[model samples]
Target: MAKISLDEMNPAMKSKQEQLLGKFEKESKTRQFDHYLLAQGLYWISIIVALYHFGTSFIGYPATHLHRSLHVAMILFMTFFLYPANKKASRKSIPWYDIVLAIASLAVAAYVWIEYINFINRMGSPNTMDVVMGTILILVVLEASRRISGWPLVILSLIFLLYGLFGRNLPGIFMHRGYDWKALVNHIFINTEGIYGTSVDVAASYIFLFIMFGTVMNKCGMGRFFNDLALAFAGSSKGGPAKVAVIASGFLGSINGSAVANVVTTGAFTIPLMKKTGYSNEFSGAVESSASVGGQLLPPIMGAAAFIMAEMLGVKYSSIVVSAAIPALLYYLGILVQVQLRASKLNLEGLPKDQLPKLKDVMRERGHLLIPIAFLLYMLLFSGATVIFSAFWAIVATIAVSMARKTTRMSIRQILDAFSEGTRAVVSVAVACAVVGIIIGVVSLTGFGLNMANAIIQLGQSNLMLTLFLTMITCMILGMGLPSIPAYLITATMAAPALVKLGIPPLAAHMFVFYFAMFANITPPVALASFAAAGLSGGDPMKTGIQSVKLSLAGFIVPYMFIYNSALLLIDVTPLVALRVAITAILGVLLIGMATEGYLFKDMVWPVRIAAFLGALLLISANVVQDIIGFSLAVLVVLFQFYWKHKKQIA
Candidate 1:
């Protein structure tokens, strides 16, 4: 393949890049308040919100309704003031209607906070006023979701609402006994199982604090330090810039929950360097996007869904992290291997050593930035502290440790900005969680989740593999439109039960759904992360998304591997079995990557690629006989490729 220079690239690509970048920045960047008074007021509001949560984390939470209502109300208030209704809306001014909405946000939350005892006393028996308040809150949550997370989540929640209200009129498997408007509203509004459900509870308690931690860390220059550390480690290797992107984007994205946000943040630097280092624009974009998305699968601070997963499964947060460790490593390893193979096939060289930062210097300068993460891990994994408590202390640790290095210190203004930015960053996630709560509410009211799971089981004819495939497809389709947290929530509620019914453990089923849900960010058509990376890399969006799918083939496969051999997830497996599964899974991913890239010892013929693909499937199947046959096939293909390449060389 020929490499295209920047000047030689098509004009349309450049135009598309600029347009996408502008759109991404408009969508993902925090709003900049122009009025000093408004800015100061918003800053203080954010700080108060942060302090409220931070204090609650240690001092013990208030009543459930009081705490969650106040939490979400503040998020809604900030969201309305910060994010406009549309791109064309003014950034510098909050419209009068928005101000009213913001005030209404507080009023609604206040109503809940004030009437909590009444709500509990009159549970399942809401009055006209309760219904009215519930309706208003529902609408408010939907509108907030639309403003923040885009229309997909809001639309999905609406569909669920419609289904709940009018299910009697629906046909076939969708039919259910319908509830009246008041009944439905009460169930969703006054009930703890509705918008105040577990999803929002986790978001309010755990996710928000962690987002604040990330924001503070970023403000203190942790993001830059991670990038420099990655470059120092990988910038002189084969496909150095690409490898740097995988490492750096993964590190940053682990804390930054949104894949699109991650791409826009880290891809800005990594994508251009990759393009300069002779990777195709599409490949570079795909690499960063896929790697960034994979960070949601990483341990310690995975995506918001992980917190929800723990809550849903009634498992410890550290357990989720432990299970995710190997698969996340394999996902990145697959990406790194593919990039190296591509670089080797193209004879691409790394950046000059003199141009790269020295590892010792980079670490010496900002190494303290790592202390917060280490502290977080220790608190969560070893100290048995609650995730919320751990995150609260981690934020404090971040602020304290930043002062260790003059360059990384956060001043009072910067600390305030971090608070404001952190609150701003969580708006979409908080809204999405609230809206998804409505879906969960409806699912519980109508028994829709169990019905859907049964339908999938019947469709799969109780075949575990077929059921897994069907669930994966459902998750990907749902995820294409929804954000990761909502996607996982919906899938875990609906599709995971099908897997569990088929005799898969609950944890494995849920984890499988979570994996595919996150993968949707790189899936085609609505691949948000890929599109964001394309914006940064000046690549075609469709091409970059497709390349992302290819590059992340292991991610697409690992869920199934774990579902088959739970050893991959460290479930009831001995060390030897875990080691065997890990080895085979890694090798399978390597071969699959080679097949996808169409290069190994040499450019692969179609037959060799097919064989490699088949071999990978067999190897990842985790069957001993299949593994033996697959390993043999892989060896044979490698030898043939090597022989052919040597003969060609002689010629």
Candidate 2:
């Protein structure tokens, strides 16, 4: 036996390493061509930048003077260095053009830095050449962002820019005198908004360190440990492996905070086991896609966007994590139930004991690895450190602990690899943040965020659900071609205020927007995670996407549930209320899984399934009248299933 690695058994996963790795081997040979080494250097460089920037700017307390130079540096690095590095070249090497581009980028930055001095000397006014160079730099940023995050954001930004330019010609409710290019550019560039505001601020600070923490953890066996942990916990029951995928992704999601990373990592293993156990290829892929795509909703860290959310709402990072506790649970509960029901439909059995890792043993060996994550939470809540400071210490703790055990210790080579990968991971986020900063800049300059919020509110006529639906639709459409962080940034900046107008709290509204941005990753037409799963499963990508949407039904509903019932979010929670919300949500998730998989105790009729869905919805909604209706209908469906089972057994 060649021993089944995560991907070899998965025809669907066979091409993934190639997709991710590109031409590293050949490129690794040369100094400039060495993508990995370059990545390594950049990672440590970022660490230094993070440390120096955070220390100098806000050691005693978080200062609001968000570093303009450092922030812009990260964006430019991602655009000209990291994003193009692997996709176009190598981790172990750099190409001549990369070096050329690098110098050019540096030159442009130098021009800005030097011009900044002269501008200060001349009473804050810059010259034409300075302005031209700045424009060129900003455009370079947008181009870089386009390469990494795709066109939805770029397109959205253009629309906003056009809105500002041609506001006077717009129809009723959308009319305003449009500004010229200079205003647009200045808003996005010269000010702390377009390339500099809260979006870029959070990115420069918290998001980067956490990303680095994930990188360190990755090399220290988080991937294998997470998989083994899921397998040990859930790999033995019917449909167990699929459930394992859900559980594993949900757990690892807290750290990686990236759906794409979660998908590629866990899908390589679990999707194959699903198919070998008789799960349909598309269904298997969908299961992985849905589960993995839940990363952005996972806590205590989510998509690195939660930190951003805290900054935007002006809340403590601890509060953001605490607020997220409930919704994240419901999200996973939904996936777990779906997996269990699917298992019932397929009649699959979990892996035999011989194949499973002993839970106690796995824990004994690697349990200390959990400390950094814990330390991170505690710091965010109590140490009074900024989120960036907390994440930096967490990264420090992760590296220090990895060395405690010989098995987990990073070799010199491994250390370099982790450093490299951490930098590599930030490329997309850094570029996206810069681009989104531009969007924010434009909105602020033109009052677009407020306008959009008011428009949505007026359109919904003060109806919360209608407003939510509209926001959801808009976010989904906007997120279709963007990364989760940037997608949420835009949503939080615009649509969230509309929810606030409708009496939703800022945290709840922003969290709601955050959830939808992630859902886009698995939504049809642009389900990036599902497409990855499809490649692994040898399944049709579109079918995989649609199935992913079906499997992840609870993801859509849970966000609505939380918005309605703050109790679910542990808002000023009591034990009784917590218990009630937990029970209702768990039951709701189970029913949802059953309805989608069309099985409970047995294959359900359309009527039974519909009843189950209704029951689940009612329970999830947490209203007394609806809960009663839902429970009664669910009982009726259960009785019907029992009756059919008894009849069949007797026959």
lDDT of 2: 0.73
Per-residue error (Å), model 2, residue 102: 3.3
Per-residue lDDT of candidate 1, residues 1-46 (tens digit): 3321212335655555546544653335345779999988888998
lDDT (Cα, tens digit) per residue for candidate 2, span 1-651 = 232333244443446634632221111122333456665666676555444544543454222322554456554654555444334455445557666665655566565566664644542244566467557766676666665665667777778778878987888767776777666655565666667677777666666667778888989877777777777777777887788888878777767777766776688788888888778989888888888778678778876777877788777777888778777777777777777776776677777767777789767767678888888888888888767667767877888888878767888778667766665666667677777887787778777777889999888887888989999988887777566778888888888888887888788888888888788888888777888788777899899999988877887898898888877777777999888887777777777877887887779989888888988888867587887787787778878888887886778
lDDT of 1: 0.84
For TM-score, the strongest prediction is 1
Error of 2 at 544 (Å): 1.1
Q: Which prediction has the highest lDDT against the true structure?
A: 1
